[model samples]
Target: MSGNTRGITREKALQLTMRKCEWCGTAIVYKNAQAVYCSSRCRVYAHRARNNPFAALRNEKRWVLWDTNKRPIMPSGAPASSTDPSTWSMGHVVNGHLNIGFVLGDGFACIDLDHCLVGGRPNEAASEFLKSYPKHYIEISPSGDGLHIWGTADEGPGTRRIENGLSVERYTTGRYITVTGRVFQPGNLLPL
Candidate 1:
């Protein structure tokens, strides 16, 4: 009842096990056995709560690559348009290369805010977008003129739109994204 002490009766504990954020007391709508937090911020707080050293690299699934002409290529020298993330190798990523794509079938999707990078600066709007999911993996686009927010989003299935001279696109499944650990914001995995 005081100083982080919580008391719950049997009925209350049972009900809570059905649904509640372990971190903040918010009601978790999609409560699963592994569900713990209500938002990305809460998730970050939870992971940081434990002070784990390698919690940051949870998303380092694999490295991506592209051809000399800036085309995405798989590890076997085939066009990367069709490849599995399981086979993506870190040995292939070239430094300062223009094209990169994570192997396909990985659950992560990309929220691409195009043209948000300009004049050696990331646009304020792009920063805001990145902040919206502070736990997601983010990076500067190949041209250094855009932002790539990588994490789980609603399965957008290649939705593309334009707003305020920025191209906002979301891709879910079937594609490996241009990935660079050059994160715009780094912490925990993004909330689903």
Candidate 2:
């Protein structure tokens, strides 16, 4: 059927190019063809509902302050609680805190893929595992050689698995994971 238009009509071709607002039920006619929402308000609602992965996590009291060494600490450089909100803050970034850590637990989990990146790109093993979760929130680790996959988990215990000589650890509680806010791939609406 190369270069053939056997039963295709011109009207059908025009209909294929028609666009609609992703948020509202209005027709879209913006100069940018990639535009999804009709306005900023619609865009915000859509982001909070689905695109923004950190929206729900911010509501919980599982935030903690971390130092540059990736250790949980208070603003005064004291040891912080990984299970308590004693040294935790509602905001991820603080005046004295160099980094922020999210206390793992409360229906949230992080799958740590250690040493998965090589020369700023995901290695063969990491790429294969990442393909299973393309829509989840993934961030580059502090060492720049690993990845952290954040998502909801069950109420049970966490597990550790080994695959392709990489350490894959999953935890729901009793631990605090560092938050680098560095996004991986684009085309995702997730706000860093």
Candidate 3:
């Protein structure tokens, strides 16, 4: 038999080490060892499933579209009320809205950290807080210098705390927070 130093032909060795595509179960031949999908279509589908980090939020009914000014508006550009369900739209609808927001209530709260980034990284206080509270869906704000930490908390009035190093606002009701879908830490919304 034609073989190399290891006594096994290269073709036989490749057959022994062959792997299957993760998405379609196809036998992957030309891809690298780290390849997961056999083709770009499979890769796209896998990414859509695994990285839809906001799937849980979309399943909820507290969604609304926002305008350029961050004000909640209906899909037809009419003003919307966070307290009014009739004005709200399903979270899954795209509807040509420039931005998306979620009404804060029903035990859900968002900790909005304003200007919490320094030199393209989270500031010290934000980093410290994230280390302590790492089990929630955290995303960078639209401005790219802040973070929105979403979690569950007791229903309460909105409160703002400003310090020398950190500025934070917590809201449990009567407000809508813009959704950027820019994830910093991927996790489920946990209790705060």
lDDT (CA) per prediction: 0.59, 0.70, 0.77
| Clashing pairs in model 2, backbone N/Cα/C closer than 3 A | none
Candidate 1 steric clashes = 4
Backbone clashes for every candidate come to 4, 0, 0
Clashing pairs in 1: 100-178, 101-177, 102-176, 102-177
Give the per-residue lDDT of model 1 (tens digit) for 147-180.
7776544444587887555678877666666665
Tens-place lDDT per residue, model 2, 1-192, is 334377656555455555777744467666576788877755753554474667656666677777667778866678888866676766534434547778876556688888889998988888988887776678888888888887655445677889877789988778888877787752232211
**Reference-based TM-score of each model:** 0.60, 0.65, 0.68
The alpha-carbon deviation from the true structure for residue 111 of candidate 2, after best TM-score superposition, in angstroms, is: 0.4
- 2 or 3, greater by lDDT: 3
